[model samples]
Target chain A: MTRDSSSTLPAPPALFDTAVVAGVGLIGGSVALGLRQRLLARRVIGLDASPEVLREALALGVVDEIQTAPGEWLRAADLVVLAAPMRALAPLARDLAPFLNPHALVTDVGSVKGGIAAEMERLGVRSFVAGHPMAGSERGGVTHARAALLENAVWVLTPTDHTPLTALSRARTLVESLGGAPVVMPPDAHDALVATISHLPYLASLAMTHMVARDERLSLLAAGGFRDLTRVASGDPRMSRDMVVENKGALREALARFRRQLERLEADLDEPDELLAAALEGKRTRDSLPIVKRSLLPQRHDLVVAVPDRPNQLGAVTQTLGAHGVNIKDIEVLAIREDGGAVRLGLESPEDVQRAAGILAAEGFEVRGRS
Target chain B: MTRDSSSTLPAPPALFDTAVVAGVGLIGGSVALGLRQRLLARRVIGLDASPEVLREALALGVVDEIQTAPGEWLRAADLVVLAAPMRALAPLARDLAPFLNPHALVTDVGSVKGGIAAEMERLGVRSFVAGHPMAGSERGGVTHARAALLENAVWVLTPTDHTPLTALSRARTLVESLGGAPVVMPPDAHDALVATISHLPYLASLAMTHMVARDERLSLLAAGGFRDLTRVASGDPRMSRDMVVENKGALREALARFRRQLERLEADLDEPDELLAAALEGKRTRDSLPIVKRSLLPQRHDLVVAVPDRPNQLGAVTQTLGAHGVNIKDIEVLAIREDGGAVRLGLESPEDVQRAAGILAAEGFEVRGRS
Candidate 1:
């Protein structure tokens, strides 16, 4: 509820004297745009191995200065964000250690965090915060970068025990000014969570793409469903490869669990009862997702209620939830039967579901399912 | 080129004396609506084991007559469509044989064709056409059904070698009247193709959902890409399970191929060059799909062009294609560079891609990739 848009950000021109954004791609360029648009930096410096991209970033006004080899820029930078591929963050830490002012805050926008934090610890990048802005598009490059790219997105920061509170607050402040909802987590927890949500899907898409890529007949017959299922498969190969490679441990675990679940479904294919139950489970799980809300995170309970067939049944249920201060995100008549139909209510947050369910059940309503 | 929208369809009342749709689900109800909307059916009858669905379908005006059982209505039927799940198709055939007139046409709308075709054959149903309307949504039910559901969609008919020409023509005419593009193929081929393109992705989604559904943290952080990738996974569990079960052989094969491709990419994660190439290949294949146009099926070739950096470069390319009568469905600058960048063009069909590419290349444009 506290999340605000970037348009409301006050000019914070002295937040950082000179900030460097390495590898000026979409995410990197967005960071630069946010810094400039919010006036958080006096000068935003761009650094990329691709000279053409660096020049384009400069021409697009993504940065006030371009760092060709990172000597003077790194020495002058009050903050350095390694907005490069996941694989490059640790190695770049050592490369920038010599030039970086010992007091300057160093962080990154890598998908994986724990290993990167550990690697940075080994590389002696002491003043560092592991960060990831969960805002991106299938498109890449500085041309697509927008100042509001991070608006309403989750910006996760993973600070180790060695990190100071000042750095965390600084990162949180920047995230907020750029219209991001900042969430703090342990580095490993962040890695594990992203692995399941992001990396696992990337690989799933990749596998499915490769599967159907060879089937010309199937590709011709492919419909919207298949297209949607594999849309992320068209991601930049290098970046995708880097994510899996860097987060191998977490991704491997997720993939293994995915494979096991698939095998279980495959086995249950012959058992109609089990298959139907699993299929319903899939529906319940999917419906439970807080897709209707614009939360930086998913927070909802899919509460299935069996309401008696009466004139004011649905109205009574809504009034009850309203009185309990629980907001219903979505409500659907999932099934209709003789005695009462099953109404699935999506409530904002698990706490809301419990409170609303308690109120409804106490009022002689049948609470069937919550996922 | 001959494709037309349903709005242009003539209202030819009394095209068919009697038409019955078994199982009043989305597809079944849509068929009845299309038939009635196009004025192709004078009297449309509905039948479903579930009396509630039958009653709803009637109330929705999807059918004029309701058939309690396959008794009297089928004997007078000019056309009969088994619109139930795949598992129910064979039994319905047997149940209808006694009532069906010898000359009456029988068809079905099952996702998997071969197994159902075989089952019908075993049941001695000779006047059958296996069909699949390549039109569907994540949501199902008669309430969601529309007369225009099949408009501009592919209605594939899989007629075995034993099928009569009259039955095939009848099915094609009905599909066309419903504003669908009719394509004919053998039943087994249809099954294999759908297994790879549709069933494989369904399983992949199921595996992913089951995998991450247990991970509350990942579900919280699930983003748009993940949602789209898993959208198909929330399908009617019974329908999804039936698809995989009926076409288990082909699905298993596709799954194996997918697993192999994944393993290959997994092995080459350390090799950046190989992984990047594979990723690019994935993009190329995905881009090749006709995502822009609403074709009966995916038919366009994705053409990649390297155009010189100029203000009128894009306009010139579009003008050239316009002059050649090659309609571009979608065009995007895939990558940007200093003097020129890579542009991907989605042409309506492969012929258009070849013609458009020829014109562009002859004018000194570099055609980089075509798939």
Candidate 2:
């Protein structure tokens, strides 16, 4: 130690000695895995009503220990995450409150925050922070859970007047450790924000779809743009109903705002310049969206390869690149024609594009750089 | 000398001995290419005001001959396609009517049908048949044209009082020969149908984008669902404005219907059952859409494969299948996690699924048949 100055540095302890997760589903299981993988907790415990789910979590190594219900073991927990269904959250929070350690930082992963936040505040749980992780899948279960589910996800944290400042800080730190960006807001504010961002858009999509469906000719003529506009209309009805109904008040306000916006657009039809300006503004905003920017990964260049529109043509192109050790960072079918279609392959570097283009050309595929 | 039965049978003549496609852009160039490739015409001619475009069209073999303007050679045409812009269609029809063969079937490929249909009727063009091929791309020009662009597309033929029955029948036959499904309707009816299907949905998407863009917090929180609902808003503003303004009357009616639908939905928020029913109806209709049905290619089975979230994983998987001669009909990223993600691969048959599963499994990939 005396010979090397760097060796004198002290090793930091784990962020938490023990962490507990309720509801061993996608969100819950993912948090358990994240805690372990990030070395943020010395031991992770899973608490689920289903013993079978607990066993699966243990087998998957998502948790070091399992509990069928709340007990004295919870007193050893320094952190607790409630990942149960919205309806189950209240009862579960009440049951665990007595056993939670005084210093435990409690949090949740629920989609809606207003009702749950009020319930948690009434329950008087230990240093609770209501959170919503803006990430999900059509599929669910512990089997589908992944540690990286939280990575780069916007984890909204709604801390009430009841929550201690230190608890909020701790929750933010944990979210950051799990590779999530923590956005703090009041519960009501969170509901209103999501109403505008998610709920209203869903309603608009559903309305457009149903309107077209009413007439056979309109439905028959619907093309790719219409398809894209209504894609979210096909999500699970029950889930959508629950989310929207829970935040109906804020959603109603958002809907009124949307209607006014639509009326203004209808009027702008007479003023071509105004209409074009609005459309241009929308295009600019859409292009600059975080999702699109993220998908356009840095250092990537696109090569559009023309392949005969036959079975396995896309596979053949990807196979050719893989064989040549050229990585396709992203791939998309740009245009589909029965005789041939264009496939845009995103490569990491210009060198990859050159190599891929040459290899594809030699394989009798026409290739061009994306314009 | 005795001849084979097949050779003795009379050969059918081409659909048109000479076909002229004006305004060599995506639709025009594609039509010219289709005419040549399908042998529907013995000689395909390209006409454009731009000599550069005419030369490019000729060089690309999209057309057998090129002309910078309407000439006396138009008299030799059996068919004339007015693929010019909305404002130029009337002038082009009038200019070509003087030199057209008496029997030449003059058709057009304009998205907005009513205005052009009225113009053609007034101009008294020979055998006018206003057509709109419900197929297009964001990218245009002779270079991007493909014969198969019209394959399996629904080409709406808006025949008017001035359109002769023989011309309509001939147009339908030609469309069929080019691998398009012929849909017959009046031009105004076509405008009304597209107003509901295309124009209204676009306005809704643009309105939603503008609403969200007004709030920075909402923009920050906008996710995949919002992105899907507003995708059409990012299209070329000039084109969108032109289409919507040209069909403003019909679009206004469609927008009014949409507003009523939205109001009904807003009222249904309190009645969860009603909300759920509406959502379910939307889902049912969306699932039954032609686009989704077409994408669910026949005899194809999906297999979900676990892949570490890294560059070229998709390529590697597709390459693996291609190397083994197992064709992938479709592939999509089902879920993305930072550490890993799940990809859904559609194989041609159950046998291909079995083979792909085994091959991917042997390569250390965790594979499972889609539930």
Candidate 3:
């Protein structure tokens, strides 16, 4: 049955019976494993250009079976997941079009969705869904793949004007079933937002890492400051390079915009009214993100407890909170002295906090904060 | 009595009878607190241009007394820590020189050392040791200051050719007493190295933070990626602005060098063979910093223990290690799954690991690792 383009509401289809996951790396392998674990697909078939990775995925139980090409698996698939690198997505979509099952709904896990969605359409691929899971690790491969990596992650979907409604419904349903929050946006908007959030951070990380690496003394004595700032530099280099190139225009513009800001700050260094506000504003912007994190829970109310420099202090507090059905929104054990540390707990809400504190204090914990 | 300069080893005289801490902010208040907490001084006096902050410092018990200006306190001081911002250092030193006792040893906590050293020389502020402690927090003020803030942190000291040996000796002794490890370098060398390590990271953080802040939508929706990379942006903007301005030349050069590298990466994005190598090299450089952290411990050894996804796991681990006389070098409790987490412990030595693991394993913890 062909998806109707004129209809706004999607007709929910049956669960995918057979799914083929192309590339079978971290993202693809996770999708394959998740489909099986979530029981969304009866058979999750894996395909990869690399034979070694195929063997690894099969041995790791990420897939029930393996296929070398589209002919071996695509015809039987009711849902096809494109989990290849950005450069490989178009060619893989081209390969699947000839063999894809008539009822199949196709989706991808590529970072950039605008070019990829257009590329799929140009190749005459139908029932396409463009999605990007905002989750990954520095260590990429089937071995690092987890069934729950995408759980609670924001899965972004970019649908163009030419997109099919039924396919969108299937994609949203699949993403929700897999425990990911699906966010819908236009292709260009998704590209722009992610370039600010994801791509630019990588570029900044690379620039700082490059700065440290080029200096002999700094390279030799790269310490905590350097380490904390460059954690994203550990991301797979070729993959990062591919991301930058695929979205070259947007990223180049981002880099230029950032450079101009840096130059402005440098110019304002001597008379720093402008620079001070910019730095403080940057901080204020960063502090706002955690509030969003807290809002995902019921609400947020933090309490700090002074704990002795002993074992199980954290465990005792957590155990007390857990017994009362209070979940910790966030936590940090900051050492305030050579002998003592404070355990700061961000509770679900102000109401949850009073009970949580009551439980802990009754159990002989030095709890601080009313709400 | 004059300090003997010809002796290869310092006599290590009575630590200090009185210490004056200028600024009464995070670094200065911490210095005041640490002096008293370490019992290195009989009286720790705080001086700040801002009486509001000085009062807060006094109320927090960071210092025994407070001074609005150096006039009331400088002549009586045996040791003085110039912990003011970069711009305030030279003038503060000049102000103190008039009322300074020839016996008083002077030092500072400025990030950039060369310019401050030259200015101190220009002001005839001898008996000066330029020092920068590579430790601080995003939260600043007397209220957040702790006696242990500088404990076990690297304190970079810049002792130019014009520096007095007595001042160098006093600085080293003070650093060691404050639980800091001192590393000496020439003023110019200190400036160049810190420009790449400290100043450039601040710039990179600023650029990324500014780019995101400038975008209304992006700023409101900054998630985990932006939060992690731009943490330094939350630092006191005035302090950072002062840092950039004072070390403008070296920092400008570092920024230019980093800009050149970004241009190279942008140019090679399409055929990124060379750029890929640079990114990978960046990762390698970032990874090596932890080894420096490990070396600071008595005798390095680490073990990872698996714990259930409930609270008190960390407290239990810390308690067990503390009971076994095993000091934890570093601790990170990583939640890999929804049901359970892993407690990675860096213990004092390999000898301590066996016993710590035995205790933890006996308590139903799954232990992993070689050292």
Candidate 4:
């Protein structure tokens, strides 16, 4: 078997002829779904230690086939994606190396990339690329597999010196085709960054939950604020535990910095004027932040017509716009009610609004400018 | 001035003849506004060292009158609400004692209750209640004050043995009239509880924010997750400072517990299988929690209506609902697009849905079942 050299090139047709996903959970299932949806492979197989999970994946249409023997699955697959627990990667990689497809491009979706990358290289899979998709809900399952989950999300791909350019490029293309924005970085840098952004926050949320758990009154009094802060604490404890344990040093550093910030705040509390002023500053900054960041794309210039809040207004408005010979690019209903409501119609040009309005007035329904 | 001792009776007209609101900022302004809005006071006066804030309070209708001198304001008011910084409350109480109306009921909106209560008692305020309204956005100012800000939110009242029954009852009624759920507890208990639920979380958020600030790359990668987690860090630095300082012991205890939780999580990460399983279990429990807890009182029954991509659907639907005599208590446009959208409506009852659907059908809308 001849391995591809250019890390940035697309995988050849023969590359993923048989791909093995080593875990059939949410991330694994989703990857399988995405690959199958895109017709990226001829056969997408799954290898899970749990017989029950493997069966569930097959039943749920997560994988076309499940291999009962790990070595057998490893031997046949042209590509392997490790989607196991962070700690399981090392042992699993070690166990599968002898039977592995020599030319296969191995990658992982583990949150911590440095240790996993080091382990893979130690196991002689130097061509392995560590990747983490920055997409997930508070829930997880094989049943949650959706091809659109990674769409428009960041997919961090970590490549070390030993990583083949062809393997890296193939992984990049695969992720991009799934609608993910690929961000490339070194393994150690990726690990540290993730620990600061993802791992530290998880730990913070867990600690918050634990603190509340210790106090009966506080927990009972918790409103939306506490709920929002501890929302991520409800994530899988096993996953969190693995993340925290694997990224202990970075988490500690993050925590220490956090503790220092707290001390600074505590000091300010002793001075009322200073504290209040500081709070005011914070309030000013926060209030100015836009509810949602503006989209990267520009707004479409369309002549929008809206229906007023009233009954039978929509049909009248649509008929009017339709009669105006103006193509309706978009129609948005701002509101609806039992008696009447408003509809916003988007036209290709601003000139369409006046014409549409005239047509609507003749249709005997109340119309208005776009809301 | 005559003060009524009838604990169950409405406060006498003269009881709050000259109400003084200290530190006329967001909470103070809201209290002043609520007092006026509810007609619970004869006069709403402001007391703030900052001339600009006092002027703003008067201009924004947060206070009926402004006082340049704290002593003068304290002497005239029958009810004195110390809505100042926690650290400032102690010294302010001392200064106000000489001018305090002999029968004035003093209270505060400070997060830390025990320390403030002790300081007030030391200053010879015989009748006082330490109160904290668990209502506020991440915003602050007289501009942010709303008469209904406290409505239906938790207002914790911490009263001591020396707190007159009449005063405590009056405070309870005031809180209830402002649309708050009164939760009465001892001062120390209240402080300890808040330290865990409120103060500790603020510190944690600040810590997380600081950690992100330390890493330029990590900060750049910060998205909704980190933004949401560190939201409280953007809160008034002074308020956070006071909370951490005055409630240090309790906060420290909470922090210690949180750190221990992180340590345990770290250990679990090191030992993956057992820890990962536990973390996953936690995530499952968290995801299933109700979006909002059922209120102690009857809450507005809301339905999320998911509509197909179309124009003027909202107006048609709302008109239909309105025609069927369904009063929309609140309306939230969750998602809006040129083609279609999803709207959530707060209604009086679930039975309103049937009538709503009928109205939509009459308006030529393809209405669906409530989400």
DockQ of each: 0.35, 0.38, 0.33, 0.23
The segments of candidate 2 whose C-alpha lies over 4 angstroms from its true place after superposition are: A1-12, A292-371, B1-12, B292-371
Fnat of candidate 1 is: 0.60
lDDT, candidates in the order shown: 0.76, 0.81, 0.75, 0.69
The TM-scores that each candidate's chain B achieves against the reference are: 0.74, 0.75, 0.73, 0.72
Show the lowest summed lDDT stretch of 10 residues, model 1 chain A: A1-10
lDDT of 1 by residue, B1-371 (tens): 11112222222134466999998899999999987765567789998888889889889989998876888658888889899877888788778877887777889998888877887778777878999988886578999999767776787899998888988988887886566778899988887788778887787777777766787666767757777777877877777877788888887777777778777876666676787777888877876776722663454365666656656767777887787788888775544455455566877876777787787777766663332
User: Candidate 2 chain B: minimum summed lDDT over ten consecutive residues — where?
Assistant: B1-10
Where does model 4 sit among the CAPRI classes?
acceptable
| Candidate 4: tens digits of C-alpha lDDT, residues A1-371 | 11122322222232257889888788888888877765556689988899898999889777899976576556777778888877687887787777887788788888888788888788888668889987776568787877667655678999999899988987886676455668899977777787777777787676566555545455557656667776777766666676778877776666566667666656665565765665555444433333322121123332323344434545655655565676777775533443333444656654676666666555443444332
Off by over 4 Å in 4: A1-18, A46-77, A87-99, A248-371, B1-18, B46-76, B85-96, B249-371
Report how far off residue A218 is in candidate 2 (Å). 3.7
Candidate 2's residue-wise lDDT over B1-371, tens digit each? 12122322122245688999999998999999888875568799999999999989999999999888787999999899999876577788888877888889889998889988887677767488899988887787788988767766788999987788999988987776565778899988999888988888888878878877888667777867787777778777888888899889899999989999999999999888999999999988877776731232233366767776556777888888888899888786554545666676877887888899998877766676632
lDDT of 3 by residue, A296-356 (tens): 3233355667666556657867876887789988885533344555665877767777888
TM-scores across all candidates? 0.73, 0.76, 0.73, 0.68
lDDT of 4 by residue, B124-219 (tens): 788788899887866788889886677666789999988898889878867765557789999988877887767777766655555555555565
Best by lDDT: 2
Total backbone clashes of candidate 2, pairs 3 or more residues apart or in separate chains? 0
Return the candidate ranking by DockQ, descending.
Answer: 2, 1, 3, 4
Count residue pairs with overlapping backbones in model 4. Answer: 62
lDDT of 3 by residue, B236-287 (tens): 7778878877787888888888788778777777667877777788777776
Off by over 4 Å in 1: A1-13, A49-61, A86-91, A164-166, A292-294, A297-371, B1-15, B49-61, B296-371
lDDT of 2 by residue, A146-245 (tens): 9767766788999987789999999997886665778899999999988888888889888888887788667776767787777778887887888898
Specify the poorest-scoring 10-residue window by lDDT in model 4 chain B.
B1-10
Error of 4 at A149 (Å): 1.8
